[model samples]
Target: MSLILSRLKCPWCETPVTKAELKEKNLLQVYLKRQAFPCPHCNQSITLPERAEKMISSGLFVSVFLAPVFAYGGWLSINPALLFSLGVALVLTGVYFQKLQKVTASHE
Candidate 1:
C-alpha cells in the first residue's frame, strides 16, 4: 500500500496547517513523524501532514510581528534609507517565496 500523508488542521480555528505559522509557536514537533499542518488563519498552532515542513516566512509576517511600532518609534530618527532597506528585504522575501513555490511545485 502507498503511504498517505495526513493533513493537519487547527483544532481551534478549523483551518489547514501551514509550516511557517506552526514554527512560530513551537507546535510542529507535536506532530513529528506524522503528516499534519498548521492552520494559517487562526493563531492556534494546529498540526497537519506533509512530506516535509517547508513554508516561507514572509516579511509581511515578520513586519506584522516586529515592525510598525518599532519603525514608528524611530520614524523621526531613522533615515529614508532604513525604509528603503526594508522594502528591499521585502522584495527579496517575495522572490524567495516564489522560488520555493516553484521548487515545491516541481517536486509535486
Candidate 2:
C-alpha cells in the first residue's frame, strides 16, 4: 500500500516543501528561511513572517480605531497634538493593512 502526501509550496517562490524539511526545523527557522526567499524562477524575495506579524500587531489594531478619532477631533483647527496622534495612528493602520491584505487575499 502506498501513502499519498499533500504538498505545500512557498506562496511567493513556489518551492516544494517536504515533510522531512519541516520535521527538522523549528518554526522560527522555517519563518526566517522565507524572509529572503529567492524564487527559483523569478528570484523575488518573500517577506518574513515575523516582519509581517509585526506589521499586523495589536498596536496597529488599536491605531485603526484611534486614528479617525484623533484626526477629526477638532475640525476647525485641528490640535497639533491631535494631528500628530492621528498621523501615528494612520501609519499603524497602513502597516496593519499591509500585513492583513495578504491573508485576506488568500481567503478570497
Candidate 3:
C-alpha cells in the first residue's frame, strides 16, 4: 500500500502528497478549466493530462454513487444535518486525491 501510494509524489522534490495536504477547493478549477497552481511540495506548476481527467471523473462518479451510503452512515451517527454534507465532502476529498495522484508535471 505504501509503495503504491509512494508513486504519488512531487515531480520536482519527489515528496509524497498526503491526503491531508491536498486542497479540495481548487480541484474543480484544475479539472474543469484545465487550470493549475503550484505544487505543495516543490512549488512548481502541476498539470493534469487526459488520463488524469478520466481518473478524476471516474472517482467523482464513484463518490456520487456512494453518496447515499455515506449519508446513511452519517445518519447512523445521529447527525441528521451531516447526511448530505458529509457525502459532498467525501466526493470532494475523492477528487482532491485523484488530482494529487494524477497531477504531475513529468506526466504532462
Candidate 4:
C-alpha cells in the first residue's frame, strides 16, 4: 500500500506540520472553517483550505461503514483484533486525508 504523505504547511511561514500535531490540535476544524490560527514558528496567522471539510465528511462515512463490518467479522471468528485494527486504519486514513487537503490562501 502506498502511503499518502501530508503536505500541510503554514501559509505564512511555509512550515511543515506533522500528522501528530494536526491530530493533537484537531486542526481539521481550522481547515474546514478556512479560519486563521497563529503559527507556532512565526506567530503569523495561518489559514487552511475549506475543501477539507468535504474530505473529513467522506472519511467519517467510510469509517462508519467499515466499523460494523469489522466488528461483525471479529465477533463471528472470536477474534476481536480485527475490529481494533480496522478502527486504527480508519483513523489513519482520516488523518492522511486531512494531510492531503490542499491549503489555499484565504482572500482576506
Candidate 5:
C-alpha cells in the first residue's frame, strides 16, 4: 500500500496529511483530545472522529497479535506460505482502516 492511501487526508480539501503536521497541531496526540486542525489547503478546521481513533487503536492491537507469529516463523526459518499469509493480512488490515476512514466523517 502507498503512504498516500494509508495516511489520513484533509476532509475539506482531500490533501494527504503528514504525522508531523498532525502532531504540530496536537491533533494526533491522543484519541480523546478532540483537537481541531486547520487544513493547509482549504483552511478548514478538521476534527477527527472518536470512532476513527478507536479503529486505529484496534488495528494496532490486531497487528500486535500477528507480529509475534511472524517473528516466531522467521526465527524458525523463512516460510513462503507464512510470508504470503502475512502480506495478505496486512493488505486486508489496510483496506479495513481505509474503509473506516472513509465512513467516519470529520466534523467541519
Candidate 6:
C-alpha cells in the first residue's frame, strides 16, 4: 500500500523532513486534523493526503479484523494490557511515515 512509502518529504521542494523536526513543529497533530502548514524548505503549504489519514486510522480497522484472533487468545490468557499495547503500537506506526502532499489546488 502507498502507506508503506509514506515519508515526511515536502511535495514542493522534494526535500526530506525529519520526524524530529515535524514533532518539534507540533505538526504531527496536524496530520489527523488535515491542517495546512508551511514547508520548512520552501514555505509552501502542505498537508497529509487522504491516504495518510486512512493509514493513520487503519489501526482501528486492523484491531477489528484481529479481534476474533485476540479474543481466542484472550480465552487462552491474552490480557488487556497486551491488547492495549498492540493498539498503541499500531497508532504510533500510523502517526509516523505520513506522506505530506500539497493541499488541493487554489479555489480558482
TM-score ranking from best candidate downward: 6, 5, 4, 3, 2, 1
Q: Is candidate 3 or candidate 4 better by lDDT?
A: 4
TM-score for each candidate, following the candidate numbering: 0.25, 0.26, 0.34, 0.36, 0.43, 0.48
Instruction: List model 6 lDDT by residue over 24-54, tens digit each.
Output: 8776566446678777668788876665446
How would you encode candidate 2's per-residue C-alpha lDDT over 1-108 as one tens digit per residue? 111123435555567544455445433343344434333334343333444334344444445554456556755665646555555665565454342112223332
The 0-to-1 C-alpha lDDT of every candidate, in the order given, reads 0.43, 0.43, 0.49, 0.53, 0.53, 0.65
Clashes of each: 12, 0, 0, 0, 0, 0
Off by over 4 Å in 4: 1-8, 16-33, 66-106
Residue-level lDDT of model 3, residues 48-91, one tens digit each, is 43454454455444456555565567634544345445555654
Q: Root-mean-square deviation of each candidate, in angstroms? A: 12.4, 12.7, 10.7, 8.3, 6.8, 7.5
Error of 1 at 29 (Å): 15
Q: Single out the weakest 10-residue window by summed lDDT for candidate 6.
A: 1-10
lDDT of 5 by residue, 1-108 (tens): 122236667766678777677567665654135555565456566655554345444544445655556666665575645655555565556545552122224332
Show where candidate 6 strays beyond 4 Å: 1-6, 26-32, 55-60, 63-98, 104-108
> Whose lDDT is greatest here?
6
lDDT of 1 by residue, 17-96 (tens): 55566577675565454433334465433323232223223344444544555566765565544554565577464444
Task: Indicate the TM-score of model 4.
Answer: 0.36
lDDT of 4 by residue, 1-108 (tens): 112236666656677865466557676456345566555556566665434445545555545765566566654563345544555565565555453222335544
Scored against the true structure, residue 102 in model 4 reaches a CA lDDT of 26
Model 1 residue runs over 4 Å out of place are: 1-58, 79-88, 100-108
How well does candidate 3 match the true structure in TM-score terms? 0.34
> Whose lDDT is higher: candidate 2's or candidate 3's?
3
lDDT of 6 at 9: 79
For model 2, the stretches where C-alpha displacement exceeds 4 angstroms are: 1-75, 100-108
